[model samples]
Target chain A: MEEKDLVILCIKGNRSAQSELVGSFAPRLLSLIKRYQPKSLSPEDILQEVFIEIFRDLKAYNPEKGVLYTWMKTIAIRLILKTRRLDQSWLKDKTVPIEYSDAIPDLDQILNKMNTDDIMKLIIALPDGYREVFNLVAVEGCSHEECASLLQIAVGTSRSTLSRARQMLKEQYAQMKIY
Target chain B: MENNRKDWRDRLDQNESPMDMGMFWNSLESKIPVQNPGKKKRRFLFWLLFLLIGSGFIGTIIIFNKPKGKIAGQTEQQKNAGVTEARESSLSPIETQHAADEIPTSDATAVISQNQSSSAATAAGDSVHKALTKYQSENISSVTKTANTSDKKTGNNSNDTQIEETASSGNASPIKEVVSENKQDQVFGIENQNIEKNAMSTAHELAQNSMAAMEYLPTLSGELYRELNWNMGYVPTFDHAPKLNQEKSGWQYWMDLSYGIGMAQHAFKTSDPLTQSYLGNRSKYESTLESRLAVWENRLIHPSGFYVSSGLRYQTHITRFDWSKEEVKIEWKLADGFVQDAQGNQIAIRDSAWQQYREMREIRQHNTISSLDIPLNVGYIIRKKQFSIEIAAGVTANISQYTSGKQLNFQEQPVKWNATEELTYKKSNTGFGASAMFRASWYPTEYLGVFIQPSFHTDFSNRMNSGAGYEHKIDFVNIQAGVAFLLFREGR
Candidate 1:
């Protein structure tokens, strides 16, 4: 059955369709959560919470705004952020300045050398504040202001954090080449 | 650099992770709570609504049925009165014959006085005596002879002779004309004297026969008088006779106050399936209490009991409804705009984030409609002595209706499902309606009465023009007990 039909059946309390709906979305949601969530939280636990929320609020979903996957992805990101406590007030004024480098690596060489998992690992290894700002602003296509509001930090702080995160990635990439 | 960032973001979006979905589904399904779908509450509300409508109809039926038995009782009472009159007439002739036999002994006067006194104790009997007195005054000779013979047999002959002498002295000129005619008869011969004696004997026989007929004559005349009085629309007063002017048809005015309970019914036609479903599932109609005060004037069109009445009434009707539960979901599509932060920095929101919020709410509503009604009714009145009953049917023109109620406003964007909006029914203005009333009244005085009226009214046009995908019309049955004070009436 189609995703929308499965969603409607799940809302009507059909058990088999509910299981199918959960099966269809759980792996994709777990993958999305794995990218954003802390390593301390279990992938299964985060996926469990996202699926529960999806079934609970299935009736609230409108296909007009976006597709079902995009909607569920948004919910998964919110749950991951909330579970990790990344959007809390503790990130206030935590931005660190990065020294500006004269010779930056070519983006094409960096892209060709690293796999997607390696790039994801590089993002996950950043500090909580830098990683949140970097994910929201660079990966999620959010503006600096949106990233600032989402992280509860100043726009200038968000801008500096992303710059510092890029510098750190460049330093790591150069080191990797030397090895 | 911006293009490089965009390319990296696109790359991140394409990334996916590999996981075992079957194992994850088993764990996730175990944690979700199961919901029980039951319609117990909805079923209870439906039964309650059904009972309310049923009771309203039953009560109206009972009220209409009551008047029939009461009318039958009134007819029975009239029949009993007629029987009593017939009995009196049947027994009266025997009493009159006995009085005639005692006339020579002067016991007839005593007997007649005794009979009149006995009959005077009852209202019907008193009317009978009055009718006899009127008849006696018109034809005096038979009654006068009987009176004279009774006096002579009682040894009051000297008193009778004195009465005659006094009468002759007062009418000496007529006595002289009678004496001259007698002398002319004497000069004519013995034959003329024989003719005079024969005429005297005939007059004596006629007087005897008239005395015998007088018994039944009084009873017939008495009954005729009562019939005439009733036909002339005369309501006999305890203090005196009904006046001549009161017999004519005229205007009667009174004021009435009433209270009752009624129910509301709704009919809907909509092209929107959602609206139709919501209305079908959620709308519960309930009974409402009402009150009315009015002043009416009836023009008695015929003495045979037809009248046309018109009144101005102010009435208030309340209708209660429970709308079905609805789940509302609103999706906000944010546009890119600059909003000043707490620090007064303009932040551009480039990403259009979709925020989905849902609410479940049930609407309970009370609609009160107050209106001024002008009713034009034509009715037939059955008037009996101090009581009257009128059954009237008419059209009532609603001059103005002011409706105040809680309504759900779904058309406004950014819907607040929990908040109720006050709606005024603008189309509730002048609408024509039909009404029927059964009024039973008792006149305690000449110009004052108390009445119990069971009335029903239904709108010819819809009472609500909400344009909210539903049309509503209301019909109500009201059992109103009220007092009527006649402001002006033709005196009788």
Candidate 2:
């Protein structure tokens, strides 16, 4: 169905249309939550919360502006960022492992052997500050300045934090010995 | 070897693992608040519709149950009142008697109408009364004047004394001429007594003859024809006479049940030329319906032969086609696999695939579609003493339809494989159409009868669009035979 039609039906509380929306986007949103890997909440629980918020604010949605997936992704990113601020840990700046920084490990070879779950596991091992900064900049492809704004930090810190996060992923990759 | 970092972003964005969609929907559906705006409106409409239909049914029942009393009473009262008014407008017998009794009581000769009996019956009596009134006043004044003069002269006899009393009652003055007339009146008065007896006899006879001849109208207490019961047919027109018979007038009810043989004409079309060709000869009118039945129909008949009827009708449509035996095949396969040991390390391996097959040929597929409907009809009846004929037209709305059979596609067929595996015949509850009917009935008893209604029904179905651009129209004829029970006698 067209997104306009789907949104109209969802607002009218059509069960089939609401189920269709949930079915089409549930796994993608769950993957986004898994990427954040919140230590306190299950990915499914967080995904449920995301859909609740989506339905609660469905009237404000305008299909003409952009597609639903892009809008939903922004909502998930903002919600994860808000959860991180509650811990107040993502605000700290972590030092890049200097000995390893000389060799920014080439991860493209190891990444080829890995599925997204394994890659996520490697990402999860990094410190909270490095992981948040890396997910915002390197994975999500946000500019260093935008990452600093969202994380409430300086551009210099985001740049340094991403390097540390990538270096840590490399060390974890070597330890796994999959390459 | 190095890969573009953007490649990982694309792969991660496409990170979809097949999950149970129903499970996720169920888990999330509860968290979403339902905010349908029409819920309250729909509920209010439901109650309003229910109340309207319920009130209509109850009102119909009460109207039908009311015994047919007023039709006869009201008609009789109106007719009688008209006759009475016409009688009163003219001088009736009792009024003429009252006019006759009003003349001078002491003098029978003053029953003066008999001498002019030909002109003095009822209408002429009014003129005669006026003339006598003048003559009595003149004679009394002359007597009074003569009595006063005779008092001035010699007042001798008792007869003159009575004359003075008549005069004194009028209080007229004495006159000389009145004295001479007093003697003449005394002799005339004696002669008037003899004549009065004969005049009274003749006047009484004349009054009786006129009373019997002209304006003796009858009321309800008088003999008129009796009102007929409901089952009897009404006369179209009757002659105007005193003995005219009145037909009963009121609302009556009849219960009817019928079974009919109906033929359905089926038409089907499609936008897809290929599907059309394949579906060709499949949707043809394979055979007519087995039977159509209608029961518990109540007809409310008006005295003028117009009626409204409503009932539940059930119809069935069956599709049968010739099927040739053909082989149907099913296949299965086992792919190459590696067996794992205790530590989850593969130890055994296979390098090839296995295939299995099963086959059979099945024949003869059929489907039956049955529908229940409520039909409302308005008709006019032509009836005699024992039989009635009615012609009517009306609409039938579908209450429900049920189909209890399956359809299949043949593997070895003339057409190539199609995406749709089965023909989906969808039916809806809102089907409505009109019909024309001609019914004839024979009553064996006063309250029970049998009837045959031959009907032509045309149903236009917008609900037939189960496939792309498919439309169907059905024309059927039903020759229905049934029994009828008459109820609620309009009048007696």
- Tens-place lDDT per residue, model 1, B1-492, is 556655656666667677777776677677564332322233344345446544654564466446445434533443334322433454333233533343232211110111221211122223333444554666543443222222222223422311111011122211110001012111100012122232233323323343332333322322332232112221145343212134567777767766665444444444433343334423434444455656565555457667788878888776665454333333455433344455433344444544332233444556777878888988876665676777788899989877777764232223333446775754565799998777777777766677877667778886555545455666665667778776777735
The candidate that wins on TM-score is: 1
Judged by lDDT against the true structure, how good is candidate 1?
0.53
Q: Each prediction's Cα RMSD? A: 20.1, 24.6
**lDDT per residue (tens digit) for residues A70-135 in model 2:** 677766675566556445565454345433232254665566567776776666556667778777
lDDT of each: 0.53, 0.51
Each candidate's fnat: 0.24, 0.27
On lDDT, the leading prediction is 1
Per-residue accuracy of model 1 over A5-124 as CA lDDT, tens digit each? 887888788989998777666666665665675333456655776676666557667777678887777766655554444335535544445534322446535654577766766666
| CAPRI tier of model 2 | incorrect
Runs of candidate 2 exceeding 4 Å displacement: A90-95, A98-105, A108-113, B1-3, B17-20, B35-492
Q: Ignoring the other chain, what TM-score does chain B have in each prediction?
A: 0.48, 0.38
Q: Chain B of model 2: TM-score?
A: 0.38
